[model samples]
Target: MRLALTSDNIAGACEAVVAEMIKAAQGEAMPYGGDPLTEQVTKMFAELFECDVAVFLVSTGTAANVLSLAALTPPWGSVLCHPESHIVNDECSAPEFYTNGARLVGVAGEEAKISVSALEQAINKRMGDVHSVQPSAVSLSQVTEIGSVYSLAELQEISQLAHSKGLKVHMDGARFANALVSLGCTPAQMTWQSGIDIVSFGATKNGAMAAEAIVVFDKNLAQKLALLRKRGGHLHSKMRLLSAQMLGYLSDDVWLNNARHANAMMALLQKGMASIAGVEIIAPAQANMLFCRLPVGMAEALLAQGFSFYTGRWEEGVVRFVTSFQTQQADVEDFIACARDLSTSHTKTS
Candidate 1:
């Protein structure tokens, strides 16, 4: 079997999502988010968060993220985020384009998470400077790029600081469910309760086909964001399809269950990798994603065995393994066994 640990979205749609999509296809309904399914999805999200929220469905996380940022910031404003944040490193400047040239200021921090002090410094750096972009918002990634999840206290501290500085807080929740399950907190507690103004609630990475939500906690931004989403050409006409995926993802706690399973698989992988000689865990594996360094030969051996993962993105020997709802335990065990064998052979040969 070719084991793939590349990313969750690569695993394809989950069974429930497929079923929901089929059901959606069988019925004709209103378009442009005027359908009942879309309305239900909005209510479902509001219920999930334990507060009234405006949920706008989009086909991609990038759309969800950039539109949310655009709603929070102005052309002359900037968004403060960690240097390794998806908006800064992975989005290919879509944020800048959506915000009409708003700057993304990278704040230095460890493990892909922005510390309150670092964010404060970044925000204060250009305050009232006409030559510099004013910090208007702060973006945080739940289950950060390096797999480190911010504690509720950490989130609260950062949100409080940003709000005190007149900055809106946005969460790029591409792995929201994973981080939520890891933190063992309610969705509301992780977001609005922590002072987050908006969230790019991602389902594609978790289990859905291509459903991502721009969940607005700050009701004031909802109308403006709806307009921005349309202007950005992200408002899907067959919106029920997107809404159905979210409906299925949320039904019977499928989202949470999927995240728990993925996290469990990652914990098993982390444990196995820890025992392999010359493998170094480079970050805190708090969610389904893990970053580690492997001996070149061991990595090559694993690849030879048809096990696939990301490598050399962060550094020379560092690799990333992302577990998904569909990741099989057997594949994980096989990978570990192969790595152990390779490590042993290399040690003996040397």
Candidate 2:
């Protein structure tokens, strides 16, 4: 079998998610999120966060993210985010388009996390300048682009600063489960309790096929987002399918179990790769994603050996490996063994 470690989304939908979808297909219910399944899923989210929340189900993380931003920011406003955040680098300006031209300001920071001081500077750069867009919201990526996770303390500090500056805090929780399990914190503590105003709660990366939710902590923003989602064309007519997937994912702690296993697999990879000569772990492997610096020859050899991953995205010689709920332990071991062999041969030749 090909050792696939490129992204968690490559994994097929878990059995529970598939079963839920099949079940939902058998019955005819209300359309356009007027169904009972959608309502139950909304309650599930509220309970998960330990507070009453408005949940908007969407088909993709990008939609959830941009819609949340659109609700929080106006056309003349600006959003502050880390330079390496998914919204800035990967979302293809959808946030800008959805907000009708809100600017995204990149704040420089280490380990893909925004520091409190840096965020303050960015927010205060032109507080009252008419020429510059006003800072309205700050977006943070949980299990950030480089695979590092922000601790609860870091999140609280940043959220506190943003709120003090009259800016809403939005978390792009594309790998939320992974980060949540890593921190061992409740969903509420990670979000609303940390002062986050909105969240793009993602399930597709974990196990669902194409389910994502825009979880609004503020009821007023939720009201606005309902219109934004409908306007953006993310309002699915057969919305029960998406709701079913999330229902399965969140039920019986399946999401948490899947994340724990994925994280464990990544930890194994991290330990194994660290012992290989010339393989440098470039970031903290806190969740299921890891970035490493590999020799060009080694990367090529692994690709030739049927190991699938990504390279040269962030920087030259850097590759990314992501584990999913379906990642097999044998495949991870095989990858490690292959890397060890390649490293030894290269060292001897050099």
TM-score of each: 0.99, 0.99
State, as a TM-score between 0 and 1, how close model 2 is to the true structure: 0.99
User: Which lDDT tens digits does candidate 2 get at residues 91-133?
Assistant: 8999999999999999988998987898899899998999989
Structure candidate 2, residue pairs in collision:
none
Q: Pick the candidate with the highest lDDT.
A: 2
Q: For residue 238, what is the lDDT in candidate 2?
A: 98
Q: lDDT per residue, candidate 1, 143-239, as tens digits?
A: 8999999999999999999999999999999999999999999999999999999999999999999999999998999899989988999989999
Per-candidate RMSD, Å: 0.8, 0.8
**Which runs in model 1 stand beyond 4 Å of their true positions?**
none
What do the candidate models score in CA lDDT, each in turn?
Answer: 0.92, 0.93
Predict model 2's lDDT versus the native. 0.93
